[model samples]
Target: MLQLREVNIDDKQTFDKYITKHNPQISELNFTNIFMWRNSYKFRFGEVGEMLCLISVPDNDEPFAFEPIGAYTKEAFIQAIDEISNYFKEKNWKLVFKRVEEDKLDYFKEYFKNGIDITDDRNNSDYLYLSEDLINLKGKKYHKKKNHLNSFTKNYEFEYVKLTDDLIDECIRINEEWCKKRSCEQHRNLYCERLANLEALTNFKKLKYEGALIKVNGKYEAFTVGELLNSDTAVIHIEKANDDIRGLYNAINQQFCENTWKNTVYINREQDLGIEGLRKAKLSYNPVKLVNKYTITCK
Candidate 1:
């Protein structure tokens, strides 16, 4: 019998081994993402042959999975999916795959052999931007962003520093203050985000994430944490800025890329969760790609 255990920090190396081989583009495929949101989603995983099977048991919803992570052949991959599907079915839960990347749709078709319910998970799709575009803020597309960045630069005497364990506290403070201003406690998503951000910082060194923070007038007002998602791209896990500070979000976003991820070809800012305001903000940056995610119900 396959048994699933809650996702933990110790799972990073094992998950990384499988994830590295797969070189996944979807945001949820990473171990950091799995671990950070484990509290909210009640994520659990188990090993099945050469694959790692992860499932999310959200309190308010049916348990679901992302496509299994690892190297696989057609037969082995389909077998792994069947194993996971059975794991849920035993408990009377219908297994569905969430955040399945666009490229993997064919695999599901093969598994079903007839038809499957594949729906767009546009809300969870990640937004990817060219690193250079963010760094330079050039051209007509980025006109307003450049102006915001310019306004921030001109008005604030700010310092940008590479994030380290010692700087983690300041970053947490910034997030906390931001939460207070917005009354994050009143919002479920925001409250969970606070927990997730704390988890990330608490395990910053363990997870081996690279990050940067900004100081305006000797106080930290903004920060972001990210790590390499694949060979060509880096993914930002968390970014927070003080709402009172004009243009601070723009300042931190540009500087974080310039300082930490310049060598990477693309910066993945992750998902907007279908929030209209968030969608609009992400669109304003003019993402080069909106990585599509899907939810596929097995037949």
Candidate 2:
């Protein structure tokens, strides 16, 4: 028997324990945003023993149920859906599922084939899939990336350090500088809150073992933090570079992929959020593939 329950960050120990045991990379998702979102919006939960399951539905909508953040067996997923459907049916609201990632298409396919309307929302920008086997480029492609890295390394001492409280503070300073120079207009408060949450989480040594900081000329220039999504996948949560430094972004990005994620078969750089410049930057990497996502609504 499965039961659903809402999550509270006050119980961070239990929440973090589950994340570390099941999926540590999803640690980024275990933030105040999720807590606030779940608080304002009612979510369905299924509990089996110590394991807790989550299913999100729009607060304004009564019938729709979004998928859970944690992984589960196909049978468990289906059972969760059935439970949500029954609850929504009683409320007379049509059920809708949004932002289903491409990897989980089979789950939606099973239900859609039975007569549910599925639509590709195309909400996210192109996702880049990096090959684990670093491209063996001998000519232009190889030279271009090599030149930038070499130039960055020669001019600035490349230092890859474990993420620490001091490193995070430096990252914040660099990020604020970049934002100011770029005249970033959106999500200023949200960004600050997210960074604060990230800083707080970084203190958990076990959870943030993979995060790194890149310093140039003994000064913080860039930083990135991420974790293994699964056995073969690593997902980058946050990456920022000093805007004043030339090629710092390229240098840190390439180095991180070359060093930290070299063992992983695939690197999910994640979504670009439909930002034009960001989309182009991600596309420029020449991803091996793209993961398409979709949304489903019952008519």
Candidate 3:
């Protein structure tokens, strides 16, 4: 059986080697995400050769594993899958892989005897956009976004601040207020997200996060957190803005990319998780591309 350990900040270096190399471009592959959601999702890690394997137990779903990260080879995946399957069997759980890239399905098909059951997990597909599109918002398609940003700048006395130790507390307070307005305590997923946000903010430095804060009228009203997912891609993990503040969303979205992640070619804002409003909001920006993801179940 593969020896799995709880995810921790200390494991980041070791994990990043494999994660960065694999560059799955999936949000879950980011170590910060795995670490922040560790307790909430019961995330655990193990290693097979140079590959990294992970398993998570979601409260509302059966325990599932992630596609092994690192050197992409048939032998490594087979070994990791077999070892993980044995681990699940001992616990009497089904062996399932979540967040499996659709492009990798053919490889798995060759490994399985009768082929695996692959399902389109549209809700979990990541929306990828050109960093330039977000920073510039120049073309006709971005006319509305430009208006929103302009409206915000013209109406409010606001400043963009780089996230530092002294400013994290303000961001946390803003997050707490946002949670109250959204009634996160009454919702499981939102509640979990709040917790995860807190964990990330508290351990922001140790997790190596880069973020920005928007201060309106000398008060922190919005914040965004992200990190380099790979050599050319930066992933935005969290972006919170006061909805009452017209154009705050557009402001933070544009400012964060312009200031902090300008060098990265692509910005991955992550998934919508089947929420209609969220899907619409993400699509409104006109993503340059969508990262197709899948769910695989081994028979």
1 against 3, candidate with superior TM-score = 1
Badly placed stretches (over 4 Å) of model 2 are 1-65, 68-74, 87-94, 112-114, 125-128, 131-139, 182-206
Rank the candidate models, highest lDDT first: 3, 1, 2
**lDDT tens readout by residue for model 1, 212-240:** 99899988889999888999999999999
Clashing pairs in 1: none
Query: Better model by TM-score, 2 or 3?
Result: 3
- Top TM-score model: 1
How well does candidate 2 match the true structure in TM-score terms? 0.73
lDDT of 1 at 259: 84
Q: List the global CA lDDT of all models.
A: 0.89, 0.59, 0.89
Q: How many pairs collide in each candidate, listed in order?
A: 0, 6, 0
TM-score pick, better of 1 and 2: 1
For candidate 3, the per-residue lDDT at 99 reads 90
Which ranges in model 1 have alpha carbons more than 4 Å from their true place? none
Angstrom error of the Cα, residue 273, model 1: value is 0.8
Residue-by-residue lDDT tens digits, candidate 3, 129-154? 99999999998999999999999999
